[model samples]
Target: MSDLKNDIPDFQTIMLPMLKLLQDGRQWTLNEVMRALTAHFNLTEEHLKIQVPSKQMGLFRNRVGWTRSYLKKAGLIQYPDRGVYQITEEGKQFLANNPPKLRMKQLEQFPKYKEWRQTFNSGNTKEKQATRTEEQTPEEVLASTVEELRNELATELLDKLKENSFQYFEKFVIQLLQRMGYGEFREDSTQHTGQAGDQGIDGIISQDRLGLENVYIQAKRFSNNSVGSPEIRNFIGSLALQGVNKGVFLTTSRFSSSAIQTALDSKQQKIVLIDGKELTELAIEFNLGVQIADTIDIKKIDLDYFEE
Candidate 1:
């Protein structure tokens, strides 16, 4: 058993609030819930760790899918379409009646979940059977199917790394950054000369040659905890160490009110903080050694052609 096994309750703690936000008759996208989750909980969306239970290995997609899978299995939620999730009647009823107090071991207590699992397994087999009958090229199928598998695996990776601390997580992010072409990036772990402390600057990356320019980064892996101004201030101080003026503060958790204010207040320093949410988005954007798992093509109608 690993740390995440023990941190299951923490993941549940997040999932409960997530379910509540969807209780209304509104459909929510994954990004929407992620935003609400980050703001409400003060977590970083970009982080593989705090974004969900499994993010570090870049398994963001699957972790989210797994959460929905668990919720749907427990009759706590439903997926109306790709990337869109809504609460079901049973899910609403369960919430109203039970008011989820999540426990890793207690997930099995939901009787509806067990029944749902039986039906779900049955349906999955039927779907597989139907797919087997479809006339499709093996290569074509492999291309698309491989992507889906990759996406699922990415989510799982993130979930597995969620329980690690900031120190360890920093190494992960640094590696990720280096893959994105940050060659001179190295972790800063101590104080230097006057006004040259390591504060928020956990790692430094040289952007250009001549050793004249660099980007400082601050990585934080928090456990359901919010980072405050002090951390930010220290990071700003670190920027001055090598005479670098620009910095990026990255965190797996979220920032506090003062933290955001501090960044905005100090215009001269030019500090950019990439919290968990943004970090994940960048990883996806850069394709920083991460493979794409799926691409769902949704067809929409041209109304003019169908006009009577």
Candidate 2:
């Protein structure tokens, strides 16, 4: 049910045991290695059932597969036949050293493995080059890569947002709030009123169809400077004129600490602040200005049928 958790070992952690299993110089099938390692690690049914993000392969099974690939690349093992592998003489010699752990750093020291890494370099990454400390499951690597990409996308989106007109920012605020499941029950529940003399209000959202309660919105498209306490006081004063106690102040820069304190100190009024970074994050999360690019699916063999 879970996908790639910390409880499961990475590909590197399984390297030593995988090599030791073949110490007898006997050929082993992939299924045999999996079964042996399953018991060897004392992995439970729940552990066995745990999958990668794609739900195509078991998390532990994927790690074992990568471990086998790395060992083969390092010349520590060989595939004599389809789905059947055995320890090589070089592997036996390496094992004779009885290294505490067979990590990527150890594998890169081998001439053939180092050459293979240079040719393919799938195993080596900027992360591995920097840390080279611990092995991460492919899922873990993918998650980190995805996070980095999102951060980059958020930065690009924020820059473009600042370039747009204040009217666009006002519309973006109303549309984003609607996309986030606000004012969805009624038509025209969210409105943009950013034109001449809009009384410090950029937009408004009706809580219900009858408009018994409303949330005032003030969107500021600042390129550099932060919103100060004076701006916040004016916005609060604008809300006071409307006899409203709820408001959202959004900006393309940031809020001054004093401005934040002002909002917190507003006794009867509730004001939520959204800065540039948070605004971009919400824009990306609610799919305001982004599109899905690709999806990956990892597959696994039907080990139960093979066991039978």
Candidate 3:
């Protein structure tokens, strides 16, 4: 089994076989493709159990997922329905040519895939070529992929957030702060002050159960208009009315340069400004509104282990 680990095929090596399996022209479920490929590859149970670095998924299965994605992108195979895989006529024709192996170089021959990949690189280079090049280690490729996924997720989250009501935005900020360990000691430590909110303050979180220490929040669900200096100054004034220091100003749009300057220039108060991008990122990091759909771990030979 340990020896088989070294022999396990990389995603590129798995791609051709996966496409062939799909070329039967009948829709196959993902599990069916996975099982057929497992037998085709002669992978052992231990091979199936071998984990990527994150250990959230089996290494061979992880490679297979990548293989499926690449083949689909190359116009070879597709998901006609959720979890149902089928090869396109183009894939069948390509299989008849009996390409020895499917790799990024081969996929680049398809105009759809080449054009699709350019969107990721956005003129820097192709996505696969940039990430999976000989110049990059496997870990580097994984990191680049994670970064791309994170950026896309952030954009999606922000869009969804903007679709909700202003009232929801107020409660959302409170929930996010609570998840960040801001009000861990009490069940009611966080509250959406809403109408009862002090001045323009939208909500409050008691840093302590006794409410001796508190953090204030002002949420702006602006769509097109950026939060300007007047908004920040008003939030600052609200803090003054409450006679306390710390506050967070969260917005769904962006902060104007003057708005940012106002927050920075607040001498007596501590002000933190969270714009759309950072707000979504924070929500993701704290697992406030997203789930871990999948994970892949990267690994390498450890020179230090041999030394040890």
Instruction: List TM-score per model, in order.
Output: 0.44, 0.56, 0.57
Q: lDDT per residue, candidate 1, 1-308, as tens digits?
A: 34433333344556677778898958899889766765765534344353332333434433455566667656667666667789988767757876646533445677655543332222322134336646666665556554444434443344334555556677667767776666644433221121234444566666555545666677777644678999888777766665778877777556888999999988668987776555655666666537664455647899999989
lDDT of each: 0.60, 0.82, 0.81
- The 10-residue segment with the lowest total lDDT in model 2: 118-127
The better-scoring model by lDDT among 1 and 3 is 3
Model 3 spans with C-alpha error above 4 angstroms: 1-134, 196-198, 301-308
lDDT by residue (1-308, candidate 3, tens digit) is 56878878888888888888877799999889889999998988888999886778899988887787667657788767777889998898898988887787788798657644543332222345455567888677666667766765675576567778889988998999888899883678987887753589899999987899999999999865789999999999999989999999998878889999999999989999998878988999999889998755547799988995
Pairs in steric clash, model 3:
53-297
Runs of candidate 2 exceeding 4 Å displacement: 1-135, 299-308
Off by over 4 Å in 1: 1-158, 165-167, 179-200, 295-308
Better of 1 and 3 by TM-score: 3
Once model 1 is optimally superposed onto the true structure by TM-score, how far is the C-alpha of residue 148 displaced, in angstroms?
13
Give the CA lDDT, 0 to 100, for residue 35 in model 2: 92
How far does residue 15 in candidate 1 sit from its true spot (Å)?
13
Whole-model lDDT, model 3: 0.81
What ordering of candidates by TM-score runs from best to worst?
3, 2, 1
